[model samples]
Target chain A: MRRLRLVIPAALALAAALALPAGAPAPAEARVGGRPPPFVLPAAAGGPTSAPFRMGDHLGQRPVAILFWATWCQPCQQELPFYESLYQRYREQGLRVVAISMDSQATIMRAGPNARRLNVTFDVVTDVDTRVTTQLNPRRAAPFSIWVDRAGRIVREQEGFSPAEQNAVAQGIAELVGR
Target chain B: MDLRRERRGAPRRRLAAPALLALVVLGASAARAQSDLSFELPGVGRTTFSLTSTTTLRYRGENYDANRFDDDFGSLYQRFDVALQADELRAEARIDLFVPHTVLVESRCVGRPLGVDDPSCYLDWDLRPERLTLRWEPSEWVVEAGDTQLVLGRGVALAFRKVDLLAVDNALRGGHVRYQGSNFRFGAHGGLANPQNIDPIDLRIVREPQDVVVGGNMAVVAPAPLGVTLGVHALRVGFEDVDSIDGVTRSRFTDRAVDVAGWSAEAAGLADGQLALYFEANGLRRTQRLVDQARSETGRGVYASAQLQLTELTILVEWKDYTNFLVAPETTEANARRIYSAAPPVEYDGPQRLRGIGNQRGGAIRMDYAFLPGPWSFSVNSALYAFNEEPHRDPFEGVLVSHSWMTLAKRQEYGGDLNWSLDLQGGARFETLLHDHDARFRSGDIDRWMIHGRLDITVGSGDHAFDFIVDHRHEREIRGDVAEFQIGGASVTYTFGIPFTLTLSLRWTDYQPGVVVSRGRREYNFLGGEFYPSLEVRWTFEPGTYLSLFAGQTPGGQLCSGGVCRDVPTFEGFQLTFVGRL
Candidate 1:
């Protein structure tokens, strides 16, 4: 009887929850205000010797904004200038912008030309196997932004890009960089 | 916000009784503080014992194999997980219960616990304690034991890993310890391998031959503008001898054993964004015991990858060679993250190739053209590898006969992909991959090509959304390697504002034998390939508390995750899964 008492209401609540129609809420980022997720991606050519690099290297040096994007994303292209502007203003403030491309090999090089055209100055690490994306974006969607403070904590995460989202993300970057 | 705190911490106190009792038995220090338990159990019927259950009650309309006399009964399986944490000490445990309506007396077993000799010889329920772990952190030293995964350096040397989707429950029954500092991290682990009870091999790994693995790794992170790091890792495994004969002995038995070890060094650095360069090299040695004596062999492999961002495009080139590089039988390097695994197609070719990775050398090139950074883009990647040594097998039966430990000669695969993704409120993507491969014998000459494509589209507003996916694959193989086969599936998913989701999926398969028995003669079947359909509904009643019900038959095909790939038998029936953490 006691077990029934607990099970009945709980079942009713769950059933009611499940009965709701589709259009689920926006999914949440797993790394918000938490320890940075583990990741390793291919570094771009030149600066450092070619090797597998991870998230720990940026700690204590400066704030880092990891923009997971692909050239094909319209919003990503629109947002590239935003990141460029931010990087330009904050570069001397120890702010680093790393645009990790989730593009196919054929399209990844395209980021190079776009960066030049957009006058975007940032690092573009390539993820071939999608390992890092799998961890950070479980849904496999990109144009996602993650802000990591100098303390190595992932302080903010914004997915996709809307004008409102753009402002919030810019503010998030400003706060993290100022910190 | 306070409710969130309550949910994370409330379950901790309620579930502390039994876990604490177990911890006490393990000599846990009482002075340690406990952390909040944030896991919430999922179920329609809930309880607060910090207990959660995932129940899958399956009903197969028809027995999978008609030749079998025993009826396939409704199977009900429930898995219960428990977790507890105190300050720097933590413990987790999971147990599974299975009850089937009918058990075949003559049948071996479809599902059984780790040590059950006859899981289905008679009708009875089953109880399996699958995993248990206890960890304690004191000051800068961390010690842990029981069912743990270890990743050393680039995983070229050590990575005992598993994937749930692939039905790979492999783990190490041991412990790992790590010491952390401002600029460096190092760790070591030692454990005995756990063989899968339901390995596709169709035979139980009789305990006579178990493998033990031990390894360690260290890494140091450098400062940026150009951040660079270097690391080294190593691991060794000793395989216990296996007795080939069964228990109903009247036969002579030969015990086979091998000792394998690997060492790797990796260097990775980045220049904020200009370019990234990475390189890794691994050396391996193995000793196998023959009928009378033991013989040894040595091999090494190096991997170097570079990404060059030129204007609007990025180009990547990678190279690798691992001839006869062998790890313990239980540690398959197929999972995607391992360095030693290398790219597909370029594998190690060794004299003692069994069922895992070894012996090949090759390089690959990939180019990306997203410079327009538009929704329309594509990539091309090609890889080729050559077997340095061909594994030798007995010509009569084609088995590794008479102590000849040789891996197969290799093959090659090169492919290109076109990718497109769009997001309004929901996300959509379409990708197609075309590739060819060689699956020949020692010469590695036989070849064929295949095409695979997938499209995911989501359309709707915030109130309700519709997600659809269409995918298909066609493969052409050498000889009867696969003849000609095609597979495709479609899924429709509806999501209701943040908490509710329903999905329906259907799949189709077409298989035609391509092999010629006598001379260009083919095998024909009057019956065609079948369709598999399934429906699932999920509800997140509360943060971590939720319920899911699945019905129908999932299609049978390759199930690959984390580089480990395998084929899973189709599952027909219903499953209800509930997870709770608090």
Candidate 2:
């Protein structure tokens, strides 16, 4: 049959040039537990705001973290001030660090005072309705990172945030606020 | 006004509000239940009646090339159907009665049997009704009609997402009105354009004209970028002039009264991601003693398409041009102003529209990409065409440009051909489903080289499923006319949940034959199988009924769609079907 059709496309082009193998792999690490999907934002400082911040309304209950930025994402603006220096080094070891802002309030009120001049204390939420980045994190891109656990349940989701994952999320928030 | 007392005063005015809400919910559930008198709640209304009938028996036989052991016979077909439906508020109306019979039962065991039976037995009849508009909106300014699909965007709902695939043609009538918000809406109707008749009465029901096209559609609320639409379409036509059977004059012998006048203009800032730029021009030019003489087939055309995203790719462009346009001719031109004296001058056939690209007059481009992120998608398209060539525009229009007798010529083998394509799709999922994968790759050329592939599999509680398809084709011809060929096919289908679905297909072809001593042979062998069974009933029905059986062998080809194509007559047959829904 015409020499088996000229040797089967020359043996499938030498098996696709020996499977052109090399490079481009590795990139999806951080994974601890689950339950971090709660949101309700309508506040850039206005009203509706009951989001990933309700660990029974603060009293020293700290230990949040969130982060999930975007503005056409440039690596989420070079990792938003290390989440504002990990909330000013665990704010008296309570650690809150919010920074949500998924843009669009005409681009986050023009970048929220350069993110409050990187002063870095805590409250700065505005997910302009990406439904809080797919509700806290359902693999919804954009430099994500979670960590709740003051019993809000979401002990680690992280996607682009390494410094050894910010020292394993500041050593698990100093072992859950024990300092 | 005694049309049976207005159809019995329409169920006595809907039995005066569900019989006054069934006597105030059966007198307060019979004063808070004193021993079940049957009147439950939470919502349920039942009133249905049905009657169905079907009978199909086909026998066709054929045998060609019978010599010595000359005995080949196979061809047969038959059909019978009956249906009825009734409802009372749980509204529904169906009446399908078809009596289709084509039987040449065992043509002397197999000498002739192909189409309409050479010996006689062909009966066809149809009547349908499943919805004669019975609607109720109660509030938002009222809507109460029966048997309807009277839609006019922004409200009223007889949807196809408001005119992207228009539909409204069924027969049987009703009337109603009301809507005072969302910018007012109203309706009125008679019937016969649609009352559930699935388009297909051969030759357009002997060339249209039974009149009954009274229209209504209004959505006027101008501002923020202009809008004006006014409509009127009328047809009471009955023009006949058919002859052909080699006797000529097969069309164009008139009669009158076909009215149509339309005006449409929509605007939304010309440039900058434009999205609505419309202009409509229609003229029927036939009022009283009908005088269209196909009026050189009057035509009008203007089109525009735009989509630009800028960041992260999205660009689409479109253009269209029209001409005398009035098409419908698959054989029926017995000298319509001299079609080469009633055919046969080698039958000159070319220019039907975009086939392997040639004779196109308009162009466009499209590009889309999302690239990696939630299962990738990519698209790359290119199209450019400008047609009409008779030795570069006019050599006395030699039969639409030297058609395949001069061997071929549209500027030497159909010029102006450029069709490019590229498409890629990707998918992945594993572990949570053991295995899930999707892959696609496509490439194109002006002449041809169309390839395709598919692979899927799922076992266990996934309810056993498997998929496979590999297609390869090659067609390139222009002058040197070596007529290349290569076709490969494979299809496997299986479904265990939807009652039944079994498909098996295999194809292979390698030829160069145009009969120059059978130039490089091996052209016959196309295997096939089709078995689909689905007929289960409950509530909600409309175009939903099936009984299919098929057997096949194919070597015959060429069948296109939308752009119209035909060249299919070569087969080994066995087909049985019964479908009804609504």
The Cα local distance difference test for each model comes to 0.47, 0.32
For model 1, the DockQ equals: 0.10
Point out where model 1 deviates above 4 Å.
A1-179, B1-53, B61-63, B66-71, B85-87, B102-124, B137-141, B195-209, B220-227, B243-267, B309-312, B330-356, B371-376, B387-446, B511-529, B557-565
Q: Residues A1-179, candidate 2, lDDT per residue (tens digit)? A: 12222322332233222221133211121222333323323223211121224323542255576777653343354345546555565677666656676653223322333233222336666654242353243224467656565644444444443222233344555665552
Q: lDDT per residue, candidate 1, B291-357, as tens digits?
A: 6665666666465667666544656676655555545432233322222222233211111122323
Model 1 clash tally?
A: 76
Q: What C-alpha RMSD does candidate 1 show over the true interface residues after superposing them? A: 12.9
Return the top candidate by lDDT: 1
TM-score of each: 0.60, 0.20
TM-score of 1: 0.60
| lDDT minimum window of 10 residues, candidate 2 chain A | A24-33
DockQ values for all predictions? 0.10, 0.01
- Candidate 2: segments with Cα more than 4 A from true spot: A1-179, B1-151, B154-156, B159-188, B192-217, B224-367, B370-419, B423-582
